[model samples]
Target: MREEAPRTVTAICRALQEQIECGLLPQGGKLPAERQLAEVFDTTRITLREALGQMEAQGLIYREDRRGWFVSPPRIAYNPLVRSHFHAMVGEQGRVPETEVLSARIVPTPAEMCARLELPALSSVIQIRRARRIDGRLVLYVEHYLNPQVFPGILDFDLTRSLTDLYASHYDIRYGRVAFDMVPTALPAEAASILKVTAGSPALLITRVNRDQHGRVIDCDVEYWRHDAIHVSVEVPD
Candidate 1:
């Protein structure tokens, strides 16, 4: 019957999911090639891929750009409510965190970012771009836009280190009240390339608009995180 296709795909997906959860497919272990898996399951490649897609969506597995699917590692717990920076948070969870500055320069603020930073047209913002990794796997790519006036000569500082510490010590400025917005998105080409994933891979976009001590908009950060690499956590205090 026509209705059998969905049932077949769901069965394949559950079988693979069980393998992953039961540790038969170890974390970071590459899955067998598509053809091999299809043969093993005695199903069409199309059906196998459909099943794999379900696993990817459920965060049980992931695919790299050129590399095939692999069992995912434990997700990093991300608490947007916490003030700690990337390195600190990863360290607290006993995972290695690495950041590399991709690019840094002064650039005319893009219209969308200009609004977020509350800057006027033709204004310049110090833009620093970086890619972050966890446990030796590429995970996040981020772009930082800062009001040039507020952070004079910001480019001189090492951009790979924590922005929070850079200004806290150099400019006597600390992160003040902040706002966070998160959305599900497909990774852009640039971000996906840097993170070693296929373009349009699933991603989580977190936009942070930060204000200074006096309540003035100081900077904004746009972060693209590999969906399977992070677990969003928010704890409410009683």
Candidate 2:
């Protein structure tokens, strides 16, 4: 029985993968309920969940809180080397992009953020929290920390607009030096909850730090993305 269950889970994963790839399970389509699926597979709910998790980690599917699993849409191609903001990049990929400003306020900088921005201890920065969706599916939760000295009264504007455009038109500041650090990590509870996934779900964390034209560190962003939602592609000129 033990050996039989392991093979059954593998069989279930394979069968569903084929179905999804063949378009029987269309992208963005919700999967049957766990109980229904378990019955179809002739397996217990526990085994079915294991199979679903395997597929989720493989970027083949995703699960929402209180909603069942869903066939994942095509992953967005992200080229970090290019200077593009969230909305621009999503639009270029032929996907509808939307952002919701969760909160924006001046917050005392934490030690880690202060060091990253090279700001003096105890300095506060404009912290903007946002949730972004692609094709109307929540996929990213991000926070922007900007040097208060560089952008005064920025909080007065609509926070959902691209920061890249605002930097040029509102402040006449262009990014000169930028750096990115990426790592595979477990999504924090705050971000995962906002994305409608379970806490500690698999995710990719991309940390971006930027300097203005005069070499002054102006802002940094911590972006938490659904691991399956983006395919990072960097293009280089030879």
Candidate 3:
């Protein structure tokens, strides 16, 4: 009976895997409830969940809080040095992009942040938190720290829109030098909660520092992304 149970789980996994591969289960489509799925697979709930867990680890599916499992969309390709904005980049790949500003405020800069921006101790900065979604899937949460002195009254503007455009129109500040450091990490509780995933799930952390024409740091951004939702690509010249 033990040997037969293992084979049953494997069979269930293969059956569902085929559906996903064949597009019978479309991307972003939610799977049926656990009880329903168990019935459909003709297996015990425990065995069915085991099969589904494997698929989740394989990046074939994901789960949302209080929601069912869903087929994951194709990973977006991100070029670190590219000047494109998030909306433009996602649109180029035939996906809809949306951004929601979670909060914005003028806060005393942390010691490390002040050092990064070359500001005096305890300088004030505008901090913005935002969530980004692609094709209706929440994929990234970002925190931006901006030098308030450079762009006074910045908090008065609509922050939920594209910051790139806002910078150009208001301050005529375009991107200059950008530095990126990316790593795979376990999602923190705050980030995972916002993205509707389990805490400590696999994720990607991207840290960026942007400079102006004069080499003065303008902003520091930290992005937390779903590990299965993006692929980083960049070209190198010999």
Q: What is the clash tally of candidate 2?
A: 0
Residues 53-120 of candidate 3: C-alpha lDDT, one tens digit per residue: 88887788988989989999999999987898899999999999999999999999989888877889
Ranking by TM-score: 2, 1, 3
**Can you tell me which runs of candidate 3 are displaced by over 4 Å?**
1-9
Task: Kindly list the per-residue Cα lDDT of model 2 for residues 153-214, writing each as its tens digit.
Answer: 99999889999999999999999889999999999999999999999999999999999999
User: How are the candidates ranked when ordered by lDDT, highest leading?
Assistant: 2, 1, 3
Judging by lDDT, tell me the better candidate of 2 and 3.
Answer: 2
Which should have the higher TM-score, number 1 or number 2? Answer: 2
Please give each candidate's TM-score. Answer: 0.95, 0.98, 0.92
Candidate with better lDDT, 1 vs 2:
2
- The C-alpha local distance difference test score for the whole of candidate 1 amounts to 0.91
So what's the TM-score on candidate 2? 0.98
- In candidate 3, the residue pairs with backbone N, CA or C atoms under 3 Å apart (3 or more residues apart, or in different chains) clash, namely none
Q: Which one is best on TM-score?
A: 2
lDDT of 1 at 28: 88
Write the residue-wise lDDT of candidate 1 on 61-116 in tens digits: 99886789999999999888888999999999999999999999999899998899
TM accuracy, model 1: 0.95
